[model samples]
Target chain A: MRQNRFVEKSIEKLLFVAAAIATISVALITIFVFRSGLPAMSGYGFANFLFGADWSPGNGEYGILALTAGTLAVTFLALLIGIPTGVCCAVFLAEILPKRAAAVFKFAIELLAGIPSVVYGFFGLIVIVPIISEHVLPLWQRVNPDAQTTGLSILAGGFILAVMILPTIVSISENAISSVPQDYREASLAVGANKRETIVRVLIPAAKSGILASIILGMGRAIGETMAVMVLTGNVAMLPKGILDPVATLTGTIAMEMSYAGPTHQEALFGVGIVLFVIILILNLAAQAIARKMGAVGRE
Target chain B: MNRKLGDISFYGIVLILSLATLAILIVIIAYVMRQGLPHISWEFLSQSPEHMGREGGILPIIVGTVFVTLLALAIATPIGVGAAVFFAEYSKEGRVVQVIRTFTEVLAGIPSIIFGLFGFAFFVVFMQMGWSILSGGLSLSLMILPTIIRSTEESLKTVPLSYREGSLSLGATKWETTVKVVLPCCRKGILTGLILGIGRAVGETAVLYLTIGGSIRIPTSLFDPARTMSMHMYMMTAEGISREKSFATAALLIVIILIVNSIANFISNRMKGAQ
Candidate 1:
């Protein structure tokens, strides 16, 4: 009996160590990234690193304004393409589809999410990049004859990112829409509003916070996506003047050049990583706050 | 009449948007299949690269991917399951548990590239693992930990409290009850989570890119550097070398992911049916 108690106690302790690993890993990552990344920023001067436009690492210039702008441009473009379509699809699954059909659609969306990011990058590289450079660029080039163009452009990255984030948005928004209470729907209908009106007004308004949470989560995904953007974004370290121009993202720069980079350049890549980490951390905290608010509302 | 028209148009727009999303999925699959299906052959699956991954097969890359993935899962499963067990059975809704939960959430949301950076700095460079399978596997294990814990906790929650009470009344300790009564019931859920973790680990590219060393040879030891299929595909596409081989590799990756996903779905569906 004493042996059994000892075994049980040891097992409990073992499990506690295992559980604590998550917290330890996060702390290590935070410490390591900042420790490696901060010195380079301080050496380069914080304002120069953050606001300088040039990224010529060979000459020791490490301005990341263009990269930050590129990340914002592509992510914003992705949101422009993803949010409305994702919300509508979520509503269709939650309210419009029959129960059996909704389940099937939900499963398909999960499958969509399951497709690897590299495969999306491959598809974008072969299919979307060609279409943009060959067909779309010709039209735009007629207006600005000297515009540099490539198959790999911001548009391709944005489109692939939009698809990549669709599942995140759709799944979360569907849950949000479905959790808006059946009484809210019936109440809206009881007041002589049609199905569309109820959805547009009462159900959507009630679920707005949750849907907003999903959008924020999707933004996190879009901003941090690496392989797809690395493949399709052409890795140009310039400020993009239009969607058709190729631009380097912070994530893309890290993945593209980290392998062959010099010591200073490598640290700069980590510096890019620091910027990315802070952005994603802020976005995640906002999403969590919104999700907690939604949970409280649900409990009430 | 105007109100009815508005309703009709709104419905049409939503329906079109939904169909468009589905259409994108279908088109991507179809396009990849069209480009890649003819290139997949027995030879392509069996041979090693001849001209920098352009002229030969992907056997070495395949072997490397499997080695790293299996090693990652081996490292992740026990720790992840243990963590889940702790969260489900031992921990209360206290400050410690709350902090752990927040940490896991943040871990899940951290970009794979950031993970790559951390892996490079801490494991490969600092620890002198030097871009080996061990470094990649350890990094991937960290990345997939949250997925495993979340899914396992979810499954563990489905186990009835009555079973624990019954076990305890029969002179079993809390740990014994968890191991014998509760865990047995949620084994399927645990399995489902494992499958999902495998799927993500197998498909991961960015974190592996820095830590895995991007070598196209089979890793004979844990410390040997290796390149995964996703990394191979990324390199091929990015460097504009061997588009045909790249397509073939992408096809294989998609097929692998689809199989893993289907199995995961099947397990969860079976669990639901059992309930």
Candidate 2:
């Protein structure tokens, strides 16, 4: 019996070691990125490297303003395009759709989410980019033909990102909407509200906190999406002058240059990564706070 | 009347958008099939690209992706399972376990590109490994570690404490009991976690793009640079002329993912049946 206790304690010890390893590994990664990025910090100095716009590797000037601008622009555009659609889809699945149909739709959304990011980039490059070139670009040209490059533009990247994050938003929002107890809907309906009125006025308000959390999470996904934007967004390291112009996001810059970049350039990329990390961390914390508050509200 | 019209528009909007999500999938699949179906051939699957401009086969990528993923899983599985065991079984619900739990959650939430950046900076830069399969695999192992830990921990929690107590009463050592009774019972759930981890590793592009240079040639060694299937697809599509080749690659990847996913679903269903 004593031997068995010893054996169990040892197994437990091993588990602790494993968990510690996982935490240490993540910390090591973040540390290494910053450590490698030190040269760029020394060379360009912190303020100039971040605030400068040009990212010409040949000239040894590594400003990330352009990439930062690109990442924010594309991510914001994706949110603008995706949020309304995602919320509506959530509402339709949670409220409007028949139960059987909602399940199928939910499964479909999960499948979409499961599709690799590379595949999304591949399809976007082949199908979406060309469409933008032939139709969307021409329409844009009619409005502003004097606009810069055509094929690979911010609009192109943003549209693809919106598609990429749609599943994430819809699935999370669906979870939030469904978690609203049925009694809430019934109570609203009993108060002389119709189905549409009950959902719009009562269910959504009740689920608002959770739904907001999902949207914030979706925004994090949009900002962090690397492969899709890397391929579709013309690798131009310039601040986007117009939605139709080429631009590079923070993620795109890191992925595109990390392979061939010199030590300083690589560090510069890591510096951008650090910034992206902090933003994502902030976003996640905000989401968690909102989710907790929503949980409290749900209980009440 | 005004309120009714507003509600009608809202419902109409919801219907249109919900259906639009479904429409997006159909459009994408249709487009892929239209462009890729003609190009997929058995020969293409078995062969390699002839030159820079010619239509290429994904044999190297298929081999490379599998090799790296399996290698990374070999490294990740034991450690991930150990961590899960510790979190679920060994550690009391205390500050350290909570911190570890939060850490894993943070890791899971991290963007894959950052993992790539770290791999490039650390393995390629500091370790002086150059761009190789080993670095890519290591990075991938890190990326999938949380998935394994989370899933395994959940499985461990599902394991009844009575089983452990029963084994203890029988004079079995805790280690022996855990290995004999607890692990075997949760094997199906642990296996499910592993399957999902493989899926994440296989589908990854950003991390591999940094750690493994997109070399389309067959890799002769783990230390050598090799391209993955997704990377090949990205390169082809980027070049813009190799649409057919790229489409075929996407189709092939989709097929592989579907097989993995279906197997995962099957195992999960079997687990449910057994329970």
Candidate 3:
């Protein structure tokens, strides 16, 4: 009995050690990135580094203002396109569709999530870029004959990201929608409300926290995404005058230059990473808090 | 009559939008298959490239992908399962659990590129592992750690408390019951979690590309530089070389992802039914 007790205690301790690995890693990543990047940000002047327009490493200019604008623009545009479509799909799956059809749709969403981002980037490169170049660019040119774009622009990046984040939003929102108590729906019907009315009035409002959580998570994804936007946006460091104009993102800038960056340049890239990290961390905490609230309400 | 018409049209619009969502995936697959199918000869799969992927096959790249992915799972499985076990069994509602769970969520929210930066700065530069299969696999292990833990914790949650009670009443200790009784019951769920983690690690391009040294050779050891299939595809497109091979790689990647997703779904379904 004593030996068994010893064994049990040791095993628990071992598991504790194992569990600490993730905590340690999170600490290490935060420390190393900040340690490496903070100096460059300070030396470069926080204002200059954050709000400068030019980003030429060769010239020692490390302004990320344009990248910040470009990232926000792309993320905002993606949320605009993704949220409505994804909610519609979720509502269809949760409230409207039959079980078997919903199963098929869920499979597709899983498949969508499973496909690599690089492949999505590839699809963007070959498929979306050409369509924009040929079809959309011509429309711009018709308005202003001097207008030119290779079709790799902020819009293309946003479109690809919207498609990429669809699975995240739809799956989560569908779960939130379906998990609303059946009594809510039945009560609406008892009060002479139609199926549509129940879903629109009660189901959506009750599930808003969850749906909002999904959107925040999706927003984090859109902001952090690197390869797809890197391949889609023309990687121009200039602030885009319009969606059709090319621009660089924070992740894109780091990715494009990290392979061969000098010391200062490397530091600046890490600085870019710090910016990206803080934004995502905020979004993650927000999503988690909202999710926790939703869970608490569900239990009550 | 107008209310009925409104309901009909609302349902119609939702169905159309849902179908449109499905059509997007179909079109992408069709387009890729159309471009990539002709390039999938046996020789293309078996041979090594001659001129930086402009001339030959992707055998080495495939081998690198398998080796790196398996290595990552090897490292991630133990730690993730252990953490999940701890969370399910030993841990209580307190500050430590809160901290750990928060950090894991933070870790998950982290971008792969940031992971790339961390891997580059720490493993490659600080640890002096240098760009190799070891560094790449180690870095990827952290990236997939959250997925494995969440899924395993989920399955662990499904294990009935009565099983442990029975084991303890019969003189088995907590560790023994957890090992012999509790774990075996949820092996399928654990397997599903590992497969899901594998799915996350396999097609990863951004993380591996930063740490793996981007070589197109079969790595003979953990210290050797190598490139995975995803990296190969990304390079082909990024460098503007070999469109046919790029699509072929993308097609194979999609095929692998589909298989992994289906397997995970199948196992989870069976696990639920058995429970």
Candidate 4:
């Protein structure tokens, strides 16, 4: 009996140890990044680093204003393109498509999500960039012929990011729509409402929070992406004059410089990471709150 | 009536949009193959990277990525599933388990770049491991552990309660019943989690870029710095190399992940049938 009791105690202890280790991993990382990034923060002070306009690592001045702007620009552009399309795709799958076909489409999107970011970067480089340079850029240039940038602009990067985030938004929004229940759809249809009207007015309004949460999740992915945008964005750390101009992002800045960055340079890069992480953390918290609200009202 | 026509049009739009999703996969595959296949060669697969005029292959990068991911899965699977077992079987009350579960969920939601930053700061710097493979694998193990545990818990929950009752009736202890009956019943689900974890580890790029310093040559040991295939592709593309080699490597990685995923799905389905 004593031996059995000992074994049970050990099992509980083991569980505690495992959970502790997991949490420690995340915590230690946050602390260490802050520690390493301290030197740069001291050197430039927070206001200058955050608000200054130039980012020339060679001459010892490092301002992230343009990089932050570029990051926000690409993220906003991606959300703009991906949200409407993803919602339409989700609604169509949930309300209109045949079951088997919808299953195939969902499977395809999931697989697309599974593909590595490196592969996405490779694909964008070979296929998307050329299409932009050869066809899209010239058309835009016709309006502004003297525009110095030919390709590798924020628009191209934003388009690629939209493609990457599409699957995430579609899947999440599909679940939102599906959770609306058959009874609601049936009641709307029984009241002489056409399928389109029922979907737009009845189904969408019912799951608005979840659909909004899906778009927020897409924003997280867009802001966090590195390799694809890094490859296509031309890495010029200046605020984009227009959507067609070149720019850099926080993720891209860290990735491009982390390897060769000097002590101050490396610390500045870590600061970029900290800023990016905080943004994503806040976004995720908002999404989780929205999701919870959605569930509570959904039950009611 | 106009309403009836509107219903038909809605259905038509849904069909077209749904088919378009599948069309994306077709377009991606077509693009990858068109750009990648012609350049694939045995030498390209076998050789190492080159800087100036030399022709390079992906031998080291492929091996390094596989080795690191396999090592991480080895360490993470037992602990993750063990925690899941404890939560599902042993936890009688509420708040502590709820907190632990929430933490795991938050960990899963944290971006890979954050994981990379954490790995870099803690594993690489605080631990003084100096961008070695072991540090990187440890970081990745933590990153994927949440996914494995959640999926395992879901699968364990699906195992019918009757099996546990039957085992207890036969004079078995809780541990014995879990080990013998419940574990066997949920083997397919557990395997699915492992497979998904593997896919995440194999495809991961951002974390590796920070934790594992990009060195193209083969690592002599786990403590050595290594470059993964994804990292290699990132480096190559960033350097503005011609698209041929980069595309070939990308295609190769995609094919490898597809095969692994399909095989995993097949095994799990077979296990489901056997049970």
Candidate 5:
């Protein structure tokens, strides 16, 4: 009996160690990334490192304003395309589609999530890039004959990012919509609202927090995405003046340069890491808060 | 009359939009298969690449991917299952558990690129693991930890409380009850989680790209640098050489992911049926 008790106690201790690994990893990552990156920030001055527009690693100038803007531009453009399409798809699946059709649509979305980012990047590279450069660029150039554009532009990056984040937004919003009390829909119908009106005015409004949470999560996915954007975007270190212009993102810069970076340059890349980390952290926290509110609303 | 027309059009538009999303997936898969399927042969699968991955096959890359993914799963499953058990059976709904949950969520939210940065700094540099499979596997284990924990915890939650109580009533210790009674019932759910974790680790590119050193050769040791299939494709595309080979690599990757996902679905479905 005593031996069995001893074995049980040991297993409990082991489980504690195992569970602690999660917290330990998070704390360690935060500490290591900041430690490596903070020195460069101090050397360049935090504000200058963040806000300075020029980024010439050759000349030792390191500012991330362009990269930050580029990240936001691609992410926002993606969200612009993704949010409406994803939410609409979610609504269609939850409300309009028959059960059998909804199941098929849901499976396709899951498959989209399962597809590797590298494959998406390849698709963007070979397919989207050529179409944009060969076909789309001519039309755009007609509007402004001097407009410089290529297949690899911010637009290609945004399109791919939108596709990549579609699954996330669709799945979450579908859950939120389906979870709404049946009585809410019945109530709307009882008040003489049509099916469309019940959905647009009543169901969507009720699921707003959950939809918002999905959008934030999608935004987080877009900003942190590296490989697809790295391959699709032209990787120029300047603020993109138009959607067709090639630009560099924070993630693109790090992935492109980090492998061959010098000591100081490596630390600066870590500085980019710190910025990306903090941005994603804020986005995640907001998503969590909104999801919590969504759960609370569902309970009530 | 206008209101009725507007409602009909709205439904039509939404229905078309949803179908378009599905069409995109179909188009991508069809395009990749059409381009890549012709290149797949025994030689392509078994031979090592030549000319910086421009002229030959992807045997080494496939081996590297399998090696690292297996290594990651081997390391992750125990710790992940343990953590899930701790959360489901041991930890109460309190501040400590809440903090742990928050940490896990944050870990999940952090981008793979950030994980690459952390892995490069902490594992490859500080720990001196170098740019090798060990570093890549360890980094990927961290990335998939949250997935495994959440799924396993969920499955553990579904196991009826009566099972645990019955085991204890038979004079079994809590540990014995969990292992002998509870775990057996939830084995399929846990297997599903592990398979999902394998899929995540296999599909990951950014984290492995940064930590795995991007070599094309077969790794003879864990310390040797190597490139997985995804990294092979990324490098090929980045260098703008060997477009056909990149297509083939992407096709193989898609095939592998599909197989993994189908197995996951099958297991989960069987588990559901049992329930």
Candidate 6:
């Protein structure tokens, strides 16, 4: 009986240690990144490292303005397309589609989400990039005539990101829309509103927080997406002159150069990692807040 | 008439957008299948590469993927399950738990590329692990830790309190109940979480690329650097090495992802049905 108590005590201690792993890792990652990265940010002058446009590490210039702009531009473009298409699909699945068809489409969406980002990158590299350069680039070139491009641009990366984030947005938004109280729909219909009117005015308005949460979450995903953006967008560290112009990303640059980069150059890349981390952290907290709000709204 | 037209057009737009999304999925999957499905064979599955993945099977790459993935899961499962068990069974809903939960959320929100950078700096460099399967596995284990914790904890919650109370009434200790009655009830759910973790680790490229040293040869030890199918496919296409072989590898990767995903979906769905 006493030995049984001992067995129980040891297991509890072990579980406590296990639960502490995440807490410990969170501390370790924070320390490691900032410890290695901040010195370089301070070395190059924080403002200069951040706002400088040139990222040619060989020349001792580690400005991340170009990559920051690239990540933002691509994320913005992805959300621009993804939000509308995703919300519409969400609405379609939640309100309009037959339940049987919705289930199949929902399964398909899950599969889309499950497909690895690496394959998404490879697919974009092979199929989407050429389509953009060959089909989309010519129209823009005809309009601008001075454009230099290989179809690898913010447009390319943004398009792939839009596709990559579609499942996330659609699945999440659908849940939000579906969670709107059935009574709202019934009351709206009984009070002379049409089905579309009820959905547009009442359901969507009610589900707005969840949908917004989905968008924020999708934006976080787009910002975090590395392989797909790296493959589709040409790795040119320049502020994109336009959607047609080539751009490099923070994640892409880190993945590409971290291997052969000199020690100083590596620290600057760590600086890049720090900036990306701050942005993602902010977005993540925002998403969590909105998602919490959505839960509260659902309870109401 | 104008309002009717507008409403009809709105519905039309919704249908078109939905179809367009589906079309994109179909196009991507179909394109991969069309390009790569014919190239897979028993020989391609069994033989080692001859020259930079251009003239041989991907047996070594497959082996590397299994090795690194297993090591990562092995490291992560215990820690993750332990954390989850603590969160589920032991901890009160307190400030500490909230802080821990918030940190876990932060970890979840972090980009994998940042994970790769940290892994490169911490595991590969500072820890003197170098770019090996161990480094990659260690790094990847952390990347998947939050995932395993979140999923496993959720499952553990689904085990009813009555079950625990029943075991307690039967003179079982807390640990004994958690290990015997509560865990058995949620083993399927735990398995689902594990499969999802496997899917994430097996498909990961950024962290592995930085930490694994990307050797295509068959790994001889835990310290030996190796490449995953994701990295292999990325390299072949990026370097323009061999299009057909890259396509084959991509097909195989897709196949593996499908299996992993299907297994996860099947388990979760079964759990749901049981509930």
Q: Write the per-residue lDDT of candidate 2 for residues A31-118, one digit (tens) a residue.
A: 8866767667667878888899888987988888998899988998999989999999888888778987886787677667767898
Q: Write the per-residue lDDT of candidate 1 for residues B1-275, one digit (tens) a residue.
A: 99999999999999999999999998988888778878999999999988889888999899999898888889888899999999989888899888887787888899999999999999998999999999999999999988888889889988888899999999989987888889899888988888888889878999999898988887799999999999998888877889899888888887887798888888998998898
Candidate 4 structure quality by residue, lDDT tens digits, B1-275: 87778778766766665566567667887788777777778988888877621357878887889888987899899888887888778776578765665566556666777788778888788789988898789889988898788778778887889999999899877787888998887777888888888888888888899998877778879888998878877777777665677778777777767776676667665765665
Write out the backbone clash pairs for model 3.
Answer: none
Residues forming the 10-long window of minimal summed lDDT in candidate 1 chain A = A291-300
Please report the TM-score between candidate 4 and the true structure.
Answer: 0.92
Model 1 per-residue lDDT at B217: 81
lDDT of 2: 0.81
What DockQ does each candidate score versus the true complex, computed on alpha carbons? Answer: 0.81, 0.63, 0.81, 0.56, 0.80, 0.74
Can you list the residue pairs that collide in candidate 6? none
| TM-scores of chain B alone in all candidate structures, in the order given | 0.98, 0.91, 0.97, 0.93, 0.97, 0.96
Q: How do the residues A3-31 of candidate 4 rate in per-residue lDDT, one tens digit apiece?
A: 98788678777876676565666566667
Candidate 3: tens digits of C-alpha lDDT, residues B1-275? 99899888877777777888789889887888889878988988999987889878999999999999999999999999999999998899799988887788778878899899999999999999999999999999999998888888889989999999999899887888889998888798889989988888888888887898989878899999999998899899999889989999988888888899999999987887787
TM-score of each: 0.97, 0.92, 0.97, 0.92, 0.97, 0.96
Model 1 alpha-carbon miss at residue B275, Å: 1.7
Model 6 interface RMSD, in angstroms? 1.5
Pitting candidate 4 against candidate 5, the one with the higher TM-score is 5
Query: Would you list the C-alpha lDDT of every candidate in the order shown?
Result: 0.90, 0.81, 0.89, 0.79, 0.90, 0.87
lDDT, model 3: 0.89
How much does candidate 6 score in TM-score? 0.96
What local lDDT score does residue B27 receive in model 5, on the 0 to 100 scale? 94
Query: Candidate 2: TM-score?
Result: 0.92
For model 4, what is the alpha-carbon lDDT of residue A106?
Answer: 69
lDDT ranking, high to low: 5, 1, 3, 6, 2, 4
Worst 10 residues of 3 chain B by lDDT: B9-18
What is the lDDT, from 0 to 100, of the residue A10 in candidate 5? Answer: 91
In terms of DockQ, which candidate is stronger, 2 or 6? 6
**Which 10 successive residues of model 6 chain B have the least lDDT summed?**
B97-106
Query: Which one wins by lDDT: 3 or 6?
Result: 3
